[model samples]
Target: MTISVNGEKKVFEKAQMSVRELLDALEYKVGFAVALNTTFVLNTTYETTMIKDGDALDILAPVQGG
Candidate 1:
């Protein structure tokens, strides 16, 4: 499947994958927010949120600014 992650296109061999799986495959650390196709996905639901082809996934992390 092909998906856009943080503005970049990524192709995967699997037909479908959960948000958690994708994060693990990409080696993402904790404490990040996720958006699937422009909608926010709760952290608790990551394991159940399935991602498909042509989907857009955004990984946002908090920043410390003064």
Candidate 2:
């Protein structure tokens, strides 16, 4: 399955993936929030939310600024 992640195209071995699983697969290490296909996916629901082919994912993390 192919999905656009942070504006870059990525291919996954599975046709479908849960939001949580995708994060684990990518080895995400920062505090972040995800937007899937233009919809906000709450962190509490990551395990249940599904990601499909041709989807767009924005993995945004908090940035520190003065």
Give every collision pair in model 1.
Answer: none
Stretch of 10 with least lDDT, candidate 1: 29-38
Which lDDT values do the candidates have, in the order given? 0.97, 0.94
Question: Largest lDDT belongs to which candidate?
Answer: 1
Put down candidate 1 lDDT per residue, 1-66, tens digits, no spaces: 999999999999999999999999999979889999999999899999999999999999999999
TM-score of 2: 0.91
Worst ten in a row by lDDT for model 2: 29-38
lDDT of 2 by residue, 1-66 (tens): 999999999999998999999999999965998999989999889999999999999999989999
Runs in model 1 lying further than 4 Å from the true structure: none
